[model samples]
Target: MSMKLITAIIKPFKLEDVREALAESGITGLTVTEVKGFGRQKGHTELYRGAEYVVDFLPKVKIEVVVAEDAVETSLEAIAKAARTGKIGDGKIFVTSVEQVIRIRTGESGESAV
Candidate 1:
């Protein structure tokens, strides 16, 4: 079966809930990273223009999970449910196809690599 990579950019605080949801959905492995960027909302500022605009870097967390195609929907739903705090900066999710996977230490392939 083919694989899918699900990447989610979420608020930092909701990470724990997302992790638990993933685990509950039978997703055992995922990679998380702290990232800084802006979206359609653009950047924000504070104070007078001359007095250090104080642009909020906007803290975010990135979660990456690879799963079989059949499991993709479940994983996506889990992430959505867990990451949804109904806040302005909750971030977004992206899903893409993966051709193959290989385990670094054991040389395993396919879903085992996940």
Candidate 2:
């Protein structure tokens, strides 16, 4: 079976919603990381100690999930619907082919490993 890696960069506040959505869609495991970056939304200004400063990199959450190819579309829909805020900086979803997967503990490979 073919596999894919779905990476989504989303607003920090929406992490829980995305996780719940993925779970409801039958996605059992995923990895999340705290990240910072800027896109078309560019960044924003913030006040700190009464001083206004430009925040070039906004806080974001990166979610990485590996699933069977057949599950890709459902996973994408789940993520998109859950992550979208109808505004800028809601985030991006990237899909890439996964050549292989291995379960280190059991030495299982391919679809089963996933």
Candidate 3:
């Protein structure tokens, strides 16, 4: 069976919204990692103890979801909608084909393994 892996980098504040949206869209599981990076916006400056400096890495949430081929677009749409903030650092979504998936405990493969 064909599968797709979706990795979304979103603002940390939007994690809950994205999680709820994914669940409502029939996505049962996913992995999340707290990350930091910069894009076209580069980075930002803030005041720390009355001192101002530029922070190069912005905190973000990385969400990884693997699903059946048929669910790819719907899942992407859901994530985009829920994570959107109309801002420059809203982050990105990446999609690629997954060659295989295995659930060791159940020995299930393909979509079942997902």
Candidate 4:
């Protein structure tokens, strides 16, 4: 069976929206990581102790989901639509090949494992 991996780095605040969207798409499994990074959106400047500072590596949430090939586009669209904020720091989505998946408990692999 064909399988795929999708990784989305989104603004921290959008995590809930993305999660709900994914669930609505019949996606029930995923991995999430608290992360920090920058792109064209770059970092921001903040005031602390009456001082100005350039805060690097904006806080972000990395969401990783694996699914059967046919579900890829739907999942991508759901995540993108949910995460969009009409702002520069919306973040990015990446899709890549996943050669294998394994569910240790049931000894399931391939699409079923995902």
The residue-by-residue lDDT of candidate 2 on 1-114, one tens digit each, is 789999999999999999999999999999999999989989999999999999999999999999998999999999999999999999999999999899999999998987
Tens-place lDDT digits, model 3, residues 2-114: 99999999999999999999999999899999999999989999999999999999999999999898999999999999999998999999999999899999999888899
Q: After superposition, how far is residue 71 of candidate 1 from its true place, in Å?
A: 0.8
Model 1, C-alpha of 42: deviation from truth (Å) = 2.1
The clash count for each model shown is 0, 0, 0, 0
Runs with alpha carbons beyond 4 Å of true place in candidate 1? 46-52
User: Candidate 4 residues 1-114, lDDT tens each?
Assistant: 688899999999999999999999999999999999999977889999999999888999999999888999999999999999999989999999998888999999888787
- Candidate 2 lDDT score at position 95: 100
Clashing pairs in 3: none
Give residue 22's lDDT in candidate 1 (0 to 100): 95
Question: In order, what lDDT does every prediction score?
Answer: 0.90, 0.97, 0.95, 0.94
Write down the TM-score of every candidate. Answer: 0.89, 0.97, 0.96, 0.96
Q: Candidate 2 clash total?
A: 0
Identify the superior model by lDDT, candidate 3 or candidate 4: 3
lDDT of predicted model 2 = 0.97
Report the alpha-carbon TM-score of model 1 versus the true structure.
Answer: 0.89
